[model samples]
Target: MAWRYRVGLVVAAVALLGAGAAQAYDVAPHRAVYRMALAKAASGSGIATAEGAMALEWGESCEGWTVEQRYRLKLGYTQGGESDVAVSFATYEAKDGSSYRFFIERARPGSMPENISGKAVRGPAGVRAEFEAPEPVKLDLPKDVLFPTQHSLAILGAAEAGQKFLSGMVFDGNEVEEATEITAVIGKQIPAPTEGEELLRRPSWPVRLAFFGPDNAPGGLPDYEMGIRLYDNGIVTEMKLDYGDFVVDATLDKLEKLPKPGC
Candidate 1:
């Protein structure tokens, strides 16, 4: 599998959000833990078995919004090789979508870790990025694009208004901090089901997103696909990742609400 798609899991939690008028979304600070396992493998996927755990924590401060995402997966491929993959991604994005700072690191057993750290700002002219790792370079981002949290909120806002589909571009610090085409499908919104402790307190809807990059040639399929149940407060209760070759299911194991940062 391609490195981009493999590390895409690092930013997976930021892909589904709302962007409609039916309801107002308030970003909630919370920590979520997910138990991951392979659901199935395709004909020539080379994947035999897999297991993993992932965590995503979102917080808010005066400077911007902060996110911490990490994953550790063990994969056994049919080609008779095994690998332990690790990924860590962190970012701080401004509320008004003006600036973003990101750091991403990926590693595999017996291999040196590779990292990308940079900052990007959006100005009237356009967006620009300066990298500090994997060699220094400047990148020009798409003028019309959203960062992870911004994109997620857009999805939520739309679902609240019963919008079925939205088309846009998003930059989640993937390969080169470039924006990738995104198509989000918002499903029916319903009240959060009552639980013993009532861990959730807002309405939620089903969301499915397809991500396509420049590398994905025309008429070709999206690099990856995601399906999730997103809460009105911007928390995901359930999710799945479809990587074309294989599919993985992430079940919410536990969740904890955090205090909002005060500046």
Candidate 2:
């Protein structure tokens, strides 16, 4: 998986659940930690083992929402090789969903380190982005494009309304030139898990999100997919990351409620 995009998108789903929910969705500011391990591997997948950890903090501000995430993974191959990947991501989205700022740093074996930072705003014309690192560039996006936080709310909104499928374009600042098309499949709501934090006790749904790249053909396979037990208040109890050849499971290990903004 492209860890940069993977980590960024993961945060997009988990951190922004505060804006949408069933029956007057309440905002939740919290911190979470998850332990990741390989759940399965396809034949000849070349993946022998995988283990990782992810830490995320979601907080509310007077004017916007803030999220910080750190992720690390170590992969062992059948052929006796290993790869260690680490990524740190942060973003802020205006409460009104009109502006966003992001920064990401990633390191992986055999690849140049990546550093990305940018700010984007929505205007009558469309979404505009101005990058500040790895070469500055200005770009315009589709008028209908949604930022990460907005996209998450849209998904939760659909779930609350009993909709099963929704698709749209989203810009998470992982790419510089264009936004991605995401198709979400919302499963029927189920009772919350019997364990974990109180936040996890709320009703949630099984959501599968498929991300398609701009270069992908219409109706083609997605670049990657994520399965999450998404709570109404924007908490994820668990996650499954599917990369076609292998699947990784992320189990929530720690969750803590955060104080709401005084404003």
Candidate 3:
């Protein structure tokens, strides 16, 4: 259950940062960047693979940019058939550098609230994201649940040492590298995710993410891998997740260039 909660939160953040409304043209100068990462693990017992892509877009509207993300996974167990799962189709707004609002549209089967709209506010000490359900449902996130969400922003926002962005959290970058590698680069613009359009655009900084095997212990989970390609303005062009027995793939099928939001 805790793993499910963490995965759900990670998926929500990813969807908002990678797939939501903020694209390269819509973001402000020097405010935000884009990143994509893949993760894979394969074991004799089962194979698990995941692909995550994110966009960091700044907003003059809310003072801080929004994050859009999209992710997919394919898992196969030695004794069971393969299963494909997608998590959190949503956008998140972080305003004034500390508060967050999430607009979630989709989730894996039976893994989310009926209608998902929520708010989270972070202080100098900690951050908490809350959801509003029609009826009260017991929701408890694992201790490590905030790592990806908070640390992702801290890394993007350029937080420094001795500063408490997520407060009381110490992220071992080396540990992160053990499981995933975040690579930043510049790339040519590609078509946006549109229905039936062909146009080329370039972004300022593009990033890719690759996840490796579980090095935490021997005889761990299998080796799985995924890759996401993103633009500086926060548009994802391609996503891939592959394990020996399962795979999920998505490409920028279409894109639409809209008028830049008035600052």
Per TM-score, the best of the predicted structures is 2
State, as a TM-score between 0 and 1, how close model 2 is to the true structure: 0.91
lDDT of 2 by residue, 166-219 (tens): 888888777665888888899999976789667777888999988887887987
Residue pairs clashing, model 2? 17-234
lDDT, candidate 2, equals: 0.80
Error of 2 at 217 (Å): 1.4
Total backbone collisions, model 1: 15
Number of the top lDDT candidate: 2
Q: For residue 63, give model 1's deviation from the true position in Å.
A: 3.3
The per-model lDDT (C-alpha) reads: 0.75, 0.80, 0.36
Assess the local accuracy of residue 260 in candidate 2 as a C-alpha lDDT between 0 and 100: 84
- Tens-place lDDT digits, model 3, residues 29-129: 22222232324343442544333333333233424444443444444455666544453434344433355555444345557533455555555555454
| lDDT at residue 113 of model 1 (Cα atoms) | 94
Estimate the TM-score for candidate 3: 0.44
Clashes of each: 15, 1, 34
Per-model RMSD to reference: 3.3, 3.1, 10.0
- Provide the lDDT at 93 for model 1: 83
Count: clashes, candidate 2:
1
Q: How close is candidate 1 to the true structure, as a TM-score?
A: 0.90
For 123-154, candidate 1 gives per-residue lDDT tens digits of 88878878878888888876676777777777
